[model samples]
Target: MLFTDLARSLPATIPFVGPEALERRMGVKFRARLGANESVFGPSPMVLEAMAEAARESWAYGDPEQYELKRAIADHHGIGMENIAIGEGIDGLLGHLVHLAAVPGDRVVTSYGAYPTFNYHVAGHGARLDFVPYRADDHEDPEALAARARDVRPKLLYFANPDNPTGSVHDAATIGRLIDAVPEETILVLDEAYSDLAPDGSLPPISLMRPNLLRFRTFSKAYGMAGVRVAYVVGEPAAIAQFDKVRNHFGVSRMAQAGALAALADQDHLRATIIRIAHAREELAAIARRANMTPLPSATNFVAIDCGGNGDYARTLLAAVLKRGVFIRMPGVEPLDRMIRVSVGTPDDLALFEDALMGAIAEVGRPTAT
Candidate 1:
């Protein structure tokens, strides 16, 4: 048996290591798990109840069209049902978009340190990725990205507002300008996975007026439905229709649709969760300050702490936290990689982080060769 040439050439590493894998390796459960931007606050009571109710019907396959979820999303966003497409999550939708736009050797443009999942999709589709370095003063510079897209003439341009790793965001006006600057034929894939966690006015208004813009939102973050694997894309009807050609129809489970629908309906829970996340972010920043680290202002559920040194120092701090049974992550690229990213969690979790971080610094501060 033989694998495809693409699969053979691709690296064998999984882009992200789940917490379960870390537990397996360490042979202990994490004391304060906050690496993945999951909502520790958990999904709404209504969402859980809906899932439980749907579970009884698990023997049947999910609606291949995902009609109910799509319709609900469309109503919420004030868009037509045809303008929506649901999938296993934004990850799956991204893969389908990459395949639809980029043939092998086609170019794809993205920020150098943007979401890795989008880059992974580009690689999987054999697209050549042209990366623009993030703006030195701003991590989420849509203008810089627009310049890169214009220069590269990529078939797909990826942007993640309230970016991962850095937790930075671009204002709606800036995003609009970037959209305007893109070539008419270029596909702009905006991953708004963190948009729900972002403050009001942070995201662009829900409008499918652009032929090239595709916006993806997920239940994985603020909704606390990462395990549910439900996400949806909003775009022009014609643009969204392309997804039907490549998506795994029954990929989204019935439980996912039911749960997500219930989650959407429960605005109160979502509001409360967002409030808690905001406070946690502030608390984490305060902790970073006490530890002599700088916490970058974040609009997402995670805070990126400037370790005040190079990547090596950040890595040391991260390892120290992990050893202390606190799971966290950092940027994988240079410069940005100097900051350790910690997701917002419950007060108890933040307390654990503060203790672990202080201990780690103290341990690493021991006298050594100067």
Candidate 2:
């Protein structure tokens, strides 16, 4: 088959093999599906109704300009419509952003193990990837990443607040410092997928904008719309316009647009979901502690439980938990891998996980020597 040299060189892989794929392979259904950071709390009831309405009108193509969705998003955030650009999801938008800001062999900097999907896109485009280690507290170190970006002067800098896998967060002041630290020539890719659930002061106002900064958000997390495949980016008009040059005009599905618009409108439902997530997060943390594991403080909808060992130990814990019909995931690299990353779930789901975790610990014991 004909292919670019980059395609020929890249490894074929899915960044995460989702639970459905696991179910097919294992020939068993998970009782509590808590992996992949998806919200078990579900979308607002209004969103479901909107999606149903959109489904009946599926004969027409979605608006290429994403006009209404953009208007709604802008209004929700109290930002100018010109500052927003909607796409399939943060995953798809990141792909477009990488394409817009980087060229083959150009540099892209991120934490050593932040979101792998961003790295996947960078690699697919043949970009040289740079890494900065997380702070000892397991948080993405904005200062360290900025220093590396200054030294390397990469084309793109990737930072996720309320980070994935770790679920740790930095306050707005620290994030502002990192944004300021980024070189004028380097585009800062601020990923805020979990921003909806973040504490009040953890996020800067939506009015914040910079020519070199692009903040990515999604309906996938708190809105419980991961299956809907819709998200958007915020940046100055000039930078936002670049997405139009390379985006799939019909990529954001009609159903997704309708659902996200409705989700945005239902602020009360969103608040309720947020409260549910917060409560579930606490329950998950307490479960971790009762299992003799250390649960890191989380501002995101998931918790990272330290297994008090290394990657192998956590991996063992995760596998045992999975075999017991509670699907959870752990980070890929250490020392974060010493912790398992579990998405918040309902009472039933959390109970299943609690039993699974205790049983797994009983069977596996603890992390042994390398």
Candidate 3:
């Protein structure tokens, strides 16, 4: 009973603890479920109907090629179908890409305290991680990242546009500059999980001209298909074709494909959901302000509120909220970890959050005067 060296070194714990697991541990249901950044609004009605229709065909395996969904995605993004690669989710796709690009001992560059899932995948493949501190202004410093890439000449560089935990976003101009600075041999993995909620001009336009850059998008956020787990990557045809060498052929389920296709077709539903999410973000920010906390401006479906203290104080607040049955999360590192992240939800959900948060604050005692 021996495990591979790589598997043996990896921690036995799951990276994310879902809300259900937490509920089971605490022996109570959460009054406000805002953690995990899921779309509480749920999927579009059209998507639901499409999934129901596809349910009858669930006995059949999905098209291994993923032709229809890929074409829909390509047309929506104004890209060629050959340039797209579909997968279970961005998480699954990331693992495959890291395996393809990085060999053991190769360097993989990412911002300190960025997406842990990417780091997890890189480590699983025995790649060395090179972390650059996040910018003081809260955005990813493209110049700093570029400098590290140049110095280390890492095989892969990963970043999320509207960064998780902090919800800070880098503009298109900044991203373009980083692209120009990266070495030709290095693969730039841009995780745009929150792209749909981003403000106009926030993301770089689709440009397959760059051979080294790969951008990932998901139906999990604004489209409200997280359970469906539909995500895709856009890059040069050569880069996309490489996925065929390693990806799970029938990984994308028929139900998921149908739901995603219907989701994509209903532009109105997507637009309405984005608008609602934007409003929820603002409402959450206002709630933070009234509570004397600072809510960082976000381009995502969640808001990170500066808890007006250190990581310990944030944890205390988190625990208090949990006691009140409101589920939320905070960063795992210093500086950024001083804030707790709350996902946008429906009005009733927000009401529960507000009540639970106020109750939690009361239970934790008032902030001390400096």
Off by over 4 Å in 1: 366-370
Ranking by lDDT: 2, 3, 1
- Using TM-score as the measure, the top candidate is 2
User: Which residue window of length 10 is worst by lDDT in model 1?
Assistant: 361-370
Q: Report RMSD (Å) for each prediction in the order shown.
A: 1.8, 1.0, 1.3
CA displacement after TM-score superposition, residue 67 of candidate 3 (Å) = 0.6
- lDDT digits (tens) for residues 1-370 of candidate 2: 7999899999999998998898889876899989978898889899999999999999999889989999999988899889999998899999999988888989999998789999999998999999888889999989889999999999999999889979999999999999999999999999999999999899988799999999999999999999999999999999999999999999888999999999999999889999999999999999988987799999999999998988888888898999899888888886778889889999999999999998999999977756
TM per candidate: 0.97, 0.98, 0.97
- Please give, for residues 1-370, the per-residue lDDT of candidate 1 as tens digits: 4988888889876778888898899776798989998899999999999999999998999899888888889889888998899999899999899989988899998888888888888899899998888888648667777877778788998888878878888788778888899988898888899998776777879873699999999999999999899999899989989999989988999899899999999989999999999999999999999987899999999999988888788888888888898999888988798888999999999999999999999887622322
Candidate 3 residue pairs that clash: none
The clash count for each model shown is 0, 0, 0
Task: Give candidate 2 misplaced runs (Cα > 4 Å).
Answer: none
lDDT (Cα, 0-100) at 130 in candidate 1: 89
Q: Whose TM-score is higher: candidate 2's or candidate 3's?
A: 2
Per-candidate Cα lDDT values, in order, are: 0.88, 0.92, 0.89
lDDT of 3 by residue, 1-370 (tens): 4988888888866667888999999898997889988888888899999999999999999999999999999899888998999999999999999999998899999988888889999999999999998888777778999999999999999888888978888788888888889999999998999999887777889863589999999999889999898899999999999999999999999999999999999999989998899999999998888888999999999999988888888898998888788899988887788899999988888878888788888888765643
